[model samples]
Target: MPKPLYQCRVLVTATSYGVHDPALKTTLESQVGEVVYNQSGRPFTAEELAALIPGFDACIAGLDRFDRQVIARADHLRVIARYGTGVDNIDLDAAREKGIIITNTPAANADSVAELTVGLILALARNIVVADRETRAGLWPRLQGISVNGKTVGLIGFGAIGRRVAQKLSGLGCQILAFDPYTDPASGEGLAHFTSREEVIASADFLSLHCPLTGQTRGMVDAAFLKSMKRGAFLINTARGELIDEAALIAALNEGHLRGAALDVFTRQPPGADHPLLAMPQVIVTPHMGAHSDHAANAMGWGALNNCLAVLRGEEPENRVV
Candidate 1:
């Protein structure tokens, strides 16, 4: 339709979307003229990306790094459409200097991520994993677990995902507290109430991170922060792995300063088999599937491909981050 809008040579680095739906690939091929694809089914490193991206006009990027070294070598890369909400993997300054348009599927998977966050909170509070494990092992074990109802739940950030979480938790009778200086207070109305960071850390029964991974936010949940949290509090993180200090979280759980933690993201993905956290009975972990529902995948794939097409057509992308 409409002459396919644009024409260029593109790389489809994120394999899930177009591969699952060939028509989507055909649509992208129609606009880009020729599209190369990544069949490896995983994210590529800087070196790998540098080698694969030089001749491409645009990329349907996943979590691959497009740093200065990679972007500097990209002789023809005009745009990058990030497959997910986060742009932390891409070096914004480098992309800007290289005149490469960077776009993300903002809020494309917000509902999915928010739902996962809530699920993690419940899993943490209810000892869901442990119970399931014990039952599967033929042991009738019962453990006392905290309930979310009437609990003081704290949100570290009030972005789209955080707001969605607050709205969902409201249905469960939780008193939500949000701490985000940059966020508009109106975002938390009815669902949550704006509060001071210290207050959230000191008072919440359950604490969840919904912030991005930035220089200021990386490793924000350190020893002092964990120590300040309410005793026997539970931590839920569906955000970036770098946001929390993993060792500190383990210490908090071991010392009984915190009850438990449910993590959908980790400091090291697919952490080593012998990782201490994996052996800990108080911890529950998932393979970072917060934004991975079929519905979300379709939306993200469509958004990422269209974003590249938009930039190729000399129009503003739907979610340009840089």
Candidate 2:
């Protein structure tokens, strides 16, 4: 007789209880036995995650810390499905050593995040928030905003999202410049690439960051880097927060070296209410909502769930991180 389908126990960490509209639990229940759900929003501590992962055959994870210790404790963990593209939160070496498949949902939220990046660039260049506030207060503040047309836009990365951002900006008549060591000449976007970050910063009228945060990129945009930018140039970061030195950015804005800046991510999530960046009129900050749009969230959920199911069935799912 044929063997019955493998009955698995699953754990979901760092997700909203009702965030998944159709609910991953409902979907997984059809294929697995007994699913445990947790809604710890932010990344969990190593100890906390370790304590919660025991006995789960599979896990759908968010930005929770999945270190070697945590993976070691999850004796039954067969697969880990990440809800987003970034797998920096997961310990890839540990998962690989344990023969646990690690996967993420890449491109599920590319359009949403790319759209947000453009919106941020516009907002920073135009002082949209400040103008709206003044107008709402019954004052006709004639604040002059910079024009994007005829400006030079420098993109720091040329990945899926970065390429899309460049395409969108190109339609706005902005000259596009990029600085990516991994840029493929065959991609054929016709955008010019600079050999050095300094060259990009000095030449572009607006700088947009689209690179991942790694050992080389962390704190790469510091005071010296900011000072090298064209006076009155603008900065936009929708990628990783740690990529920019917050203190250096603040100082540059205060010194009038930069016209303005926009950030959708932060080194610290939900930075203190009194964060200095919040107090600056020229700095626009969003609560890391780059990929949080409803459409993006739903797409991410479905993609992650599908990937998990594929791995469970011993298929090579797309976006496998390990």
The candidate that achieves the highest TM-score relative to the unseen native structure: 1
Worst 10 residues of 1 by lDDT: 1-10
Candidate 1 structure quality by residue, lDDT tens digits, 1-322? 2123455788888757765567778888776678888878778888999888877788999877888899999998888999998999899999999888999998888899999988888888888889999999999987887778999999999998999999888889889999998999987778888989999989899999999999999999999999999999989899999999999988999999998888888887767788888888888888888987877788899999888888877788989898
TM-score result, candidate 2: 0.91
What TM-score would each prediction reach against the true structure?
0.95, 0.91
| Candidate 2, 1-322: lDDT as tens digits | 2112257777777465237576655777778767777755666777998998887777888778898999999887778998878887788888999999999888877888889999988887788999998899999998888889989988888787888887777778888788788877456256555547678889888899988878899999999999999999999999988999999999999999998898888888778898999998888888887888778888888888888787777788887888
lDDT scores in order? 0.87, 0.82
Candidate 1 accuracy as TM-score: 0.95
Top candidate, metric lDDT:
1
Error of 1 at 68 (Å): 1.7
